[model samples]
Target chain A: MIQRRHALTVRVTHWINAVALILLLMSGLQIFNAHPSLYWGPSSYTGAGPIFELAGGFPSWLTIPGTQWLAMGRRWHFFFAWILVINGLAYLIFSIATHHVTRDLAPTRSDWRSIGRSIADHLRLRHPQGEAATRYNVLQKLSYIAVIFVLLPLMVLTGWSMSPRLDSVWPGWVDIFGGRQSARTLHFVIAWLLVLFFFIHVFEVIVTGFWNNLRSMITGRYRIEHEQR
Target chain B: MASGGVLLSACDAASRNPHVTKVLSIGEFLSQHVQHAVTSRTALAQEFTEADLSPEFRSNGTDYPDSAEYRALAMNGFVDWRLRVDGLVERPVELSLDQLRAMRSRTQITRHDCVEGWSAIGKWTGTPLSEVLALVHPLADARYVMFYSADPMDDWGTRYYESIDMEDAYHPQTILAYALNDATLPIPNGAPLRLRLERQLGYKMAKYLMHIELVDSFARIHGGKGGYWEDEGYEWYAGI
Candidate 1:
C-alpha cells in the first residue's frame, strides 16, 4: 500500500534541518577546540578550574575546517545558526497553523495506554506494519515532540543566554541556567543529546525500513508492504 | 592544530576560500542588526557580587609589550605616559595616569567573556570613557571611539587597535580601567590602563593604553576593520 506520510513543508524542512545541524555541530566542536574545556557557574578561571576538561578537545575530522581555527569555526557556526533558526521557525509556524501538532504529533489517550507494549515491541526489534506503519508510534511521536518542542527551543535559548549582546535584553536572564558559563555547559550537553537522538533515529530507520523511510522524508511518499492476514 | 583529520579531508580547502567567507558574512551582518534592534542602547551587562569573583583571571593573547617605548614607560611605572585624546574632538586633550585615577570612578564586578568561550569575573575600577569624552568634547562628526594599544600584534609593529560605536563608547560600564581587584593593574592584564566593554567579548577591550581617537569611520584604518582581530578574520562586532 502507498500513502502520503510527510507534508511538503515537512520534507523540505527535514532536509534543511539535517544540513544545518551537521554544519552547526561540526563548527561548534571547532569553536570548542579553542578552549578545550567546560565549566559551571559564572566564571571559568575561578582557581577551581573547569568541571570537565578535554586536553586536546574533539578530533579535527569532527570539526568543520578539519583543523583548528577559532575564527573560521565561529564563522561557520554563526552562519548556519541563522539558517537553522529560520528553518525551525518556519516549521513551527507551519505546524501550528495546519494543526499538524495535534493531528500527527500529540499523543492520544490510547497512545498513552500502548506505552508499555511499544517499549516491548521496540526491544524485540518489531515495528507496526500495514496501516499502523503509515502513522507514528507513540514512542516516535514522543521523541519527536521532545526534540521539537523541548530540546531545540532550549538549545536556542541557552545559546542566546551565552551571548553578551542578548544578555542586554534582560539583565540576568542567563541566571535561569545558573549563569553564562552554566548556559554554555547546558548548550554543550544539549548538542550531544541531539547527536544521540540522530543516531537512534537513523538506527530505527535502518532496522524498520531504510529505503521506505528515507524516501518518505525526501518525497513525502511512504510505501507499506501490507501484512498477510 | 597538528592533529590529523579523521573525516572530510576533501572539504578543508573549501572552508578557507574567500568566496565561502563572503557567503558566511550574511549571518554576521544579520546578527549585528538583530542584536541592536532587540536590545536597548543603555542596557547593562549583568554584574556580579564580590563572592563571584574569579580567583585568577586568565590573560590570553599578548601579555606584555615587546616594544622599547612600552617597556620604558612600564619601567618608570607609567608616570611619563600620557593618554592622547584627539581625532574628531574639539579640545583634543591629553591626560596622565594620575589625572585619570583622580576622575570620579565607577566600579563594578563584571565578567570578561572571550571569543574562545572562556569567562572570568573581576572587579574593575576606572575612569569612565564618557568622562574623557566629556573633557575632549567630541565633534558632531564623531561616530566611533578607536583605542590604540601598546602591544604590537604583528612583525610590522601594527599596534593592536579596537573601536566601538558612540552608543557603547558612552555606556556607563565602558571605562578605561586602571585597576583590577582593588590593586594596581598588572603587566599581564594591560597595565597602566585597559578598556572594559562589559557587553562585548574580550578582544573588543583593547589593552595597554596609548591613544583614544574619535572618528567618523574606521574604514581608512588598518585592514579597514575596527580592530586587530577584525583584520585577522574575527567578527568586528564580537558581542556574541
Candidate 2:
C-alpha cells in the first residue's frame, strides 16, 4: 500500500525552505567573511578581542559569490531572508488552520513513553514498517518541532536585533540576548545548529529508504513494503 | 566589498547576471521602504556611557587622505580648509574650521556598525547637522544632501562621497564630527570633519569632509547613484 505522506502545501513549502536556507547560509558566509570574526557582550571590541575570530573567514564554494563580496553577499542574504520568512509564515498558518500541529506534529503521551524504544530502534537502524511507517516517529516530530518553532524564529529575531535602526525603535530589546554582538553570536550559532540538523536529516533520509523518503517528499507517495496490516 | 577584491573570473563572466541582480534589488527596495516607513521620526540610535567606549578606535578605508588638497590643508592645520555648503540652498556658505567649532555641538557615544558585521563604539563630538542646515537653509526643492570627502577611492581620482535625506539631516545625533574620544578627530578618522549618521552603517558616514551639497536629486552626480560605494552596487540605504 502506498501511504500519502506529505501534503501538497508541505511539499511545496519544504522545497522553498530548502532553496531559501541554502542561499541564506551561503550568502551569510559571504557576509561573515567580511570581518571574519564573532564576538560576545554588547560590542566586538571589549579590549578582549573576539572569542571566535577567524584570521581568514569561511572559504569559497561555501560562500554565495565563491569570493569575498560583502555588498553582493548582503544582497543575496536579505533577498532569501524574505523568502524564508514568507514561506515559513505560510507553513505556520497552514499548520494551525488545518490542525496539522495537533494531528501530526505534536508528540503524544504514547510517543513520550516510547522514547527508549525509539532510541533503540534508531540505533539499530530498524525503522517502523507497514501501518506504523505512515506516521512520523517520536524523534522526527521532536526535531521538526524544535527547528521550525524554536530555532528559525530565534534566528530571525537575532538577525533583526543586529540592525541599528530596529535597535533605535526599541532600545534595550537586543539586551535580552546580551547585546548586538552577543545577538550576532547567537545568530551565527543558531545557523550552525540548523546546518547540523540538515546533515542529520539527510543522513536519516538515506538510511530509512532513500528513494522511499525522497519520493514521499517529492510526490507525496511512500510505498509501505508489506500489504498486510 | 569595501576592499575585498573580486578574485574570480566567474564574478565577472558568470555571476554578474543582470536579471539575478535586478531580482535581488527588489529585496533592497522592500527593506528600504518598509524600514523607513516603520521607523519613527523621534526614534534615536542607542547611546552609551563613557565606559562603553572602545579602548582603541579602529577605522577602515582612507584613514588619512593623501590628496594634495587634503595634505595642504592638514599641513596648515586646516586653517585654510573650508567646508563648502552649496547646491540647493539659499545662502551658499563656506565655513572655516574655527567657525564650525564655534557652533553649538552635541556629543554622543554610539556604536559604529560596519556592513561586514563588526561594531565599535566611540565618543563623537561635533556640530549637529541641523545647526548647519539652519545656516544655509536648504531650498524647498532640496531632497538629499550630498557629502564630498577628501579621500579619493580610485586611481581615476574618484573621491569618497555619501548622501542622506532631510529627515536624517536634522536628526539630533546626526552631526559633523570633528572630535573622537574627546580628542581632536584623528586624521584616519575623518580629521577636520566626518558624518555621524548614527542610524546607518559605517559606510554611510563619509569622512575627511570637504563639501556639503544640497540637491533635489543626485542624478547629475558621479555615476548618478548618490555615493561612491552606491555606484559600485551597494545599497544607497545602509540602515540595515
Candidate 3:
C-alpha cells in the first residue's frame, strides 16, 4: 500500500543537508590540500612534523576547485557553511517543536533491547515485513539520533574552533578541543565518519527498496510491499 | 531529484570556471561582516609563553627581497634604511631603524597562523603602530593604513604590500616589529621591520616593510585590493 511517509519539512531539509554536506566535504578537501597535513596542539608549521600528512595533492575529481586553490576553496567552504548551519538550526527547531524528535528519532527501552536483534537482521539483509516497514527500525532511530544530536553539533564546534576570530570570543572552544590543530584533525575525522554514514545510508536505500525509499524522500509517499512471512 | 540535478549542475559550473571565484567573493564579504559583528573591535589574540614557540618558524612567501636596492640596504645592516610614513598624514615622517627602536616598544609571544594551514609561535618586540601613527597624526580622511614591502613577490618587480582598517591599525598588538626572539629580526623573517597584525593570518602581516601609507581607501592601490594576496584572491579581512 502507498502511504505518506516523510514530512515535507524532513524531505526538504534532508536534501538541503545532503547538498550542504557534499559542498563542505569537497571544499574542505580543497582547503586541506593547501597544507596537506594535520597536527595537534596550538601551533604547527613546516619542519615541525605534522601528526598526519597527505602526500601528493588530493585528486581534482574530489576537491572543489580541482587544483591548489586555497582562496577559492575558502570562499566555497564559508559560503556553504552558513547554509549548513542555518538549515541545521531550522531542522532542529522544527523537529523538536513538532515532536518529531520524541516520536520518530528518540530511542525507548524497547528500542534499546531490540537494537542487538536489529543489527543481526541488518547483517542478514532481512527487510522488515508489512507494517514494520512503515516504522523506523530501532537502529535507524539510534543512528539518526546520534547523527543529529552528536556528530553534526561536534562538526560545527570543531569548525568554529579553527576560526582565528571566533577563538578570541570563545577561547574555551579551542581549549575544549585541545587546540586549533586538534580541532582541525577532529573536524577532518568526523567529516570522514559522516562520509561513511552517507555511503551506508545510500547502500541501505538501495538494498531495502530503492524506488520506495527514493519516492518517500522525494515525494513524501512510500509503497510498502506485502510479503508472506 | 530534479532540484538536486539543478543544484549539482550549478556546483559543477562553479567548480569548472575560475571567474566563479570572483562571484563567490560575496561570501567573503558576508563572512567578514558577520565576524566583525561578533568579535569586539579591541579583542586581543591569544598570547603564549616562550616554551610554546616552535623549534622553527617557517618563513612564508618571499623570504628575501630580490631587489638590488633592498640588497644594498641589507648589506649595510639596514642602518641607512628608513620606514617612510606618508600620505594623508598631518606630518609625513621617515624614521630610521634606530629611531623606531628608540620609540616606546611592546614585546609579546604570539602564535602566527598562516593562511596555508600552518602555525608557529615566536616572541616579537616592536614599536606599537599606534604610537608611530600618533607621531605622524593621520588626517580625518585616512581610513586605512597600507604597509608596502620591499620584497618583489614576482619577477615583474611588484612589491608585496598589505593594508588594514583603522580598527586593526590602532590595536595594541599591531606593531612594526624589528626584533624576534630577543634579537634583531632575521633576514629570512622580514628583517629591519615587519607589520605584526596579530588578529589576522600570516599573509596579512606584511614582511620586509619599507613604506607606510595612510589612505582614505585602498581602491587606487595595486589590483584595487587591500593586499598582494588579496589581489591574488585571498580575502582582505582574514580574521579567520
In model 3, which residue pairs have backbone atoms overlapping below 3 Å? Answer: none
lDDT of 3 by residue, B1-240 (tens): 565456545766785677876667767787788888988887877888888877776798888899899999999999999999999999999999999999999998888888877788899999999999999999999999999999998878889999999999999889899999899999999989999988788899999988999999999889999999999878998977
How far is B123's C-alpha from truth in model 1 (Å)? 0.4
Model 3 segments more than 4 A misplaced: A45-48, A227-229, B1-23
- If ranked by DockQ, best first, what sequence of candidates would result? 1, 2, 3
**What is the clash count for each candidate, in the order shown?**
0, 1, 0
> Candidate 2's residue-wise lDDT over B1-240, tens digit each?
432334333433335898878888887887778787888866899889899899988888898897898899999899899999999999999999899999999999999998878899999999999999999988899999999999988789999999999998988899999999999999988999999998999999999999999999998899998899999889898878
* Model 1: how far residue B201 lies from native, Å: 0.3
* Top-down lDDT ranking: 1, 2, 3
Candidates sorted by TM-score, best first: 1, 2, 3
DockQ of 1: 0.70
On TM-score, the candidate that comes out on top is 1
Among these predictions, the greatest DockQ belongs to 1
Q: What DockQ does model 3 achieve?
A: 0.49
lDDT tens digits by residue: candidate 1, A94-184: 9999999999999999999999999999999999998999888999999999999999999899988888989989998889998888899
Error of 3 at A7 (Å): 1.6
- What CA RMSD would candidate 3 show? 2.6
Candidate 3 residue-wise lDDT, A197-227, digit = tens: 9998999999999998999999999997778
Could you tell which candidate, 2 or 3, scores higher by TM-score? 2
Report residue B213 deviation for candidate 2 (angstroms): 0.6
